[model samples]
Target: MTIQVDENEQEPWTVLRISGELDLVTSPLIRRRVHAAVAGGRHDVVLDLSAVRFCDSSGVGVLVAARRLMRSCGGRLRLILPARGAEDGAHVNRVLAALGVRRLFEVYEDVPAALDERTAPLSA
Candidate 1:
């Protein structure tokens, strides 16, 4: 399956809602988009992966890279991984957890929480 990334602005955050399968073939698209957002001076990023159905190692790599990029620029990176059903980004959560990198990201249940400065990330 293919991947789709839709960009939106939520004040201090650039929200990228990604859906579909994230594998070796489609991971580069996400990487480029994150880089573009950073290059455009948008540091605070929120990756809404709640709609993603599948994730592979390459996709996880891109996420880690994005995290690094944000940190390098003194920016914040948040991930939206709703704890709803299995298909709603749970796969990515599982993948990240299995890889022992879930704690490396700040995760939220939704966009509002991710955007809220007073809110705390979900425990890894």
Candidate 2:
């Protein structure tokens, strides 16, 4: 499947909803889109990965790099990952966990939660 990253703003956050598979071929597209968002002056970012069906190492690398970029700018980065039982568990979620990189991110179970400032992120 192809990847689609749409940049949108909701108050204080820039929501980037990513859909389709995220593998080596499509991951750089995602990375560039993310950099574009930040370069366009967006600091609070949320990656809505609920529609993602697969995530390879390249995808994970983009995620890690994005997190670092956000931190470097004193920006915020949140992620929407399916809960443990949803969609047999989100592909990116599993990939992050297996790679021991899940704890590096602020993950949420849904968009609403990720966007809500009052709601704390899920423990990694």
Candidate 3:
């Protein structure tokens, strides 16, 4: 399946809403987009993975790399991973958890909460 990534600005953060399968073939697209955003000076980023249906190790790697990149640049990275059963939940979330890397990211239930500076990440 084809992966679609839509980018938008939410004031202090740039949100990237990704949907479809996240595997070896499509993961590079995400990495490139994140890199481009960083290259363009956008540090605070929110990855909206609520719509994602599947995620593989490559996708997880990309996410970890993104987090690392943001930190290296002194920026922040957040993830939107809706709780299970909430509109199909977040497949990427499950993958990250299974891989034991979910705690590395600040995860929120939605974009609004992720963008809110006063909000806190959900437990991993």
TM-score of each: 0.95, 0.94, 0.95
lDDT of 1: 0.93
Error of 1 at 39 (Å): 0.5
Q: Rank the candidates by TM-score, best first.
A: 1, 3, 2
1-124: candidate 2 lDDT, tens digit per residue = 3988787889788898999888999999988888988898888899999899899989999999999999999999999999756773377888899999999999998888988788988987
- Measured over all alpha carbons after superposition, the RMSD of each candidate to the real structure, in angstroms, is 1.3, 1.3, 1.2
Off by over 4 Å in 1: 84-87
Give lDDT tens digits, candidate 3, residues 10-86.
77789999988888999999999999999999999999998888888998999999999999999999999988556
lDDT of 3: 0.90
User: Taking the tens digit of each residue's C-alpha lDDT, what string does model 1 give over 7-106?
Assistant: 9998899999999999999999999999999999999999999989999999999999999999999999999996635646799999898899999999
For each of the candidates, give the backbone clash count. 0, 0, 0
**What's the CA error at residue 19 for candidate 2, in Å?**
0.7
Please report, in order, the local distance difference test score of every candidate based on alpha carbons. 0.93, 0.88, 0.90
